[model samples]
Target chain A: MFNYLKPNNLLKIINKTQKFVFIIFLVIISIGLVEALILSPEDYKQSDSVRIMYVHVPAAWISLGIFSLIAVLSFGILVFKNKNLSLITKSLSPSGFVFNVIALVTGSIWGKPTWGTWWAWDARITSMLLLAFFYLMFLLSWRVTDDEKKAVKISSYIAIIGLINVPIIKFSVEWWSTLHQPSSVNIFTETSIHASMLLPLGIMTAAFALFSLLIFLMKYNTELIKIKNKGLDRL
Target chain B: MYGKKVKLRAIFILSIFFSLILIVFLVFKSLEENVVYFKSPTEIKDLTELTSKKIRVGGMVKEKSINVNQSEVNFVITDFKNELIVNYSGSVPNLFEEGKGVVAEGFLKDRNFFTAVKILAKHDENYMPPEVEEAIKESN
Candidate 1:
């Protein structure tokens, strides 16, 4: 089973899976865009500007979700000293950073028309900005260190430290008075959103998740190629 | 030996993770006042003394309480229990209306009145088609 984890075998698996993931991502995103933009209902008050929620909400969720995954994987690396897990985290951060930027920029644009201000130092917004910085630090730790062991150790510590921000970001609105409203969708309680808009949101979140998977596969495949070029047999 | 080392490392990592959470939890608790984006009208009304410091008061705009004049606009902000009259001299956001959420940024004149320099419309979490909203409004 361990021999099956070699770069040559992993590269073959990645190559086959990447193409299918890309195709699926493209199909889901196309359907999601149509649903979010064309079929979703215009907001009662915000009008067309509310459409930004489709992109903003999903992007925010993806960024937060990826960071939490990275934190958990980093914990695994710390305990088990898994080399492959570190590589996976290194590949995942770029897509996570991109989505973080998309969420912040789209949110700013949404705020201007609705809130009468482009930015506010509200709890939710500020914590999200901190999360972007945490992603930056985690990405930087990987590049700034030369030794593989050093890079892995430094990045793992950074992730663990950053993990604290994830819960803070989630509960920011509930814990403080934020310019942003409290969550309308809850799993345990009733959801305030109408089904028409909720449908688009759900579809868009699925599409974004698939798109992130495509990015991760391509990135992980490249890492495998590099290892194969270096004449390494296993991670 | 290797298994024992890994076990120790796992304990170390979990301890570190929990401690970091504890430290941050305390820090956020300490900075509670600063993190609050706005105060409600009820909170303002409960204040024993009013200060001229710039603050944000947020609540629903009372129906039939908005009075617009050439120089300034006055409206009452209500939390359904306590109400504060706000005077502002600026353009309001598009979502500002009676029976809607708002946050006024300015100074407090007294316990019952606030002087605002800027008005921000706070939108609720509800989203639906305009027709559906209209129907809901009619039934109300």
Candidate 2:
């Protein structure tokens, strides 16, 4: 399984899968946007402003999801001493950071029309900002450390410590008096959203997940190439 | 040597964890006082004392209770059993109207009077906009 970490093997996998993944991502995203923006009914209270939910919710979902992935991968790195897991974690962080940024920006825009404010120090928003800081710290750990081995260890620790913020972000609305509303969709029980709205949101979420996977694969391939070049320099 | 280095690293990491826990605890404790719990007009009326601290009052706008002045709007928030007057000077949201659920965030002047710095309109999950409803009615 670790043989896949080799540069030549990763290049072969990327060559075979990249085009297919790109086409699938593009097609799904295009269909999802049309369904979300046009096919879905306007919200009774928010009107068209609710359309931002299609983008905002998925971005927030991806951000949280990817950070959790990094945390798990970090565990694998420490427990199994798996270099491959570290590479994958490194690849996923930028996408997670980008999604976190998108979620914050879109949420601010959505808040203005509904909550009559661009920003608030509410628990939900503040926890999300904390999550963003964790992502930044994870990225910065790699940059500031000169020792490759030490960088991996530090970043892994950062990811594990930061995992606490994920649950806080998820439950902030329910646990505190926040301006942001509670989640419309809940996993333990029935979602509050109607099926008509759920379908488009589902599509967009799938598209975003697939898109993040594409980015991860590209980043993994680049990291493998860098490792190969470093080995050559050592020789 | 390897075991000793590992022990030091473990201690460092554990210290970081404990410090982070302490920070979060302190932050939440301080913020607890600042966090204003949402209350309904009925709940507010039942309160033993009305402090001047900021709070949020949420309930439906009473029918024909809104009076829009040149700079300020005065309205009544009702939970059917009780009603509280809310005074706001900033522009109201587009969805804010009679019978809609609203959350007013500000200091309470008294059980009968509340001054709102911000107003958030809450809507039900139903998708029947007035224009869409009118269109469907005409077609029917």
Candidate 3:
């Protein structure tokens, strides 16, 4: 088990996985794009515009997922004082921010067709905007702090505090009457989803996952390289 | 040295964990039930099936279609090809007007008219909202 924990060994695993994930990612994205853009049946009601769901939903999911991950990683760094863990968390922040912005922008784009307004203060929409701001606050904290350890600690607290918004965003429809529609993705629901639409959505999501992984790896590797160069400079 | 090594290990593990979550999200999102798009009457005629499913419809307000009775407002939406009658009973946007592009969100009733929960008016030239532009372009 300890042998499995070695850095070189772990790096080897990551490198191998990256290659396979990259291929899977490419295939999934291509399939999803084709399915979403062409194969999926036009919505019985919305016609072709329903295609936006493929992009909007995934972007929203990724943004939320990324923020949650960042918070968890930040917590680990603060509680354990792990340098590399902190670096990884730091590296992930910008990407998380990008996804959050994408989610908001895409949601608005989708909204204009459905809501008749580009922006609204509805519970769901407002909470998501708050989540985006939480990400921005975490990113800004790093820029303001000179001490890495202090920054990690403060950011971790901020992340944990910000997590309160996630649940609010999720349950906004039920807790309060909002113009935004309620969740239709619940596992307990008995709705029948068509295969043609499902397939493309699945493929696109896979592609997005792969794309995020590729970005995280590239960013993490750059961070490692930067630290190594700093060490060399010390010599 | 052990501390540094552990830190490196944590980074690897966290990255993998995050990646896995992303993969799962992708799969789940694709499988989830999706919201239907809103279409103009002209676009709806081209669809293969139509029944009780939720949808959005958009078009310009015909000049004589507006009928107001207290909070409820009834109007007809035309895409220059087909027309759909719409009924709304909520606060309207300032820009809502006749002969202007509008999108109404909701579903069609058995009565052969759209019952809108929300209504949006299109902005001006060189500055149309992305969603409005996308919906308009998509129907064409």
- Please tell me which predicted candidate would have the highest TM-score against the true structure: 1
lDDT of 3 at B51: 62
Any runs in candidate 1 off by more than 4 Å, and if so which? A1-4
- For residue A163, model 3's alpha carbon misses the true position, in angstroms, by 1.1
DockQ of 1: 0.84
Off by over 4 Å in 3: A1-19, A232-235, B1-72, B75-140
lDDT per residue (tens digit) for residues A61-95 in model 1: 99999999999999988988888999899999999
lDDT of 2 by residue, B1-140 (tens): 34665566556666776788778768877877455347788878888988887788888899999999899999999989999999999989887899877889898998899999988875543444446657767999
Poorest 10 consecutive residues by lDDT, candidate 1 chain B = B43-52
- The TM-score each candidate achieves on chain A is 0.97, 0.95, 0.88
Which candidate would rank higher by TM-score, 2 or 3? 2
Ranking by DockQ: 1, 2, 3
A1-235: candidate 2 lDDT, tens digit per residue: 6734456766788877988999999999999999999998887667798889899999999999999999988876776567878888999999999999999999999888887778877778888988999999999988997998899999999898898788878878777666677788888976777677888899999999999999988887788788887874210
Estimated TM-score per prediction?
Answer: 0.96, 0.84, 0.62
* DockQ per model, Cα: 0.84, 0.31, 0.06
Q: Report the lDDT tens digits of candidate 3 across residue range A58-163.
A: 7777778777888777767654666767667777777677877887888787666644677865667877998888988888887888886688777776776676
**lDDT of model 2, residue B64:** 97
Q: Which ten residues in a row have the lowest lDDT in candidate 1 chain A?
A: A1-10
Count of backbone collisions in candidate 3:
4
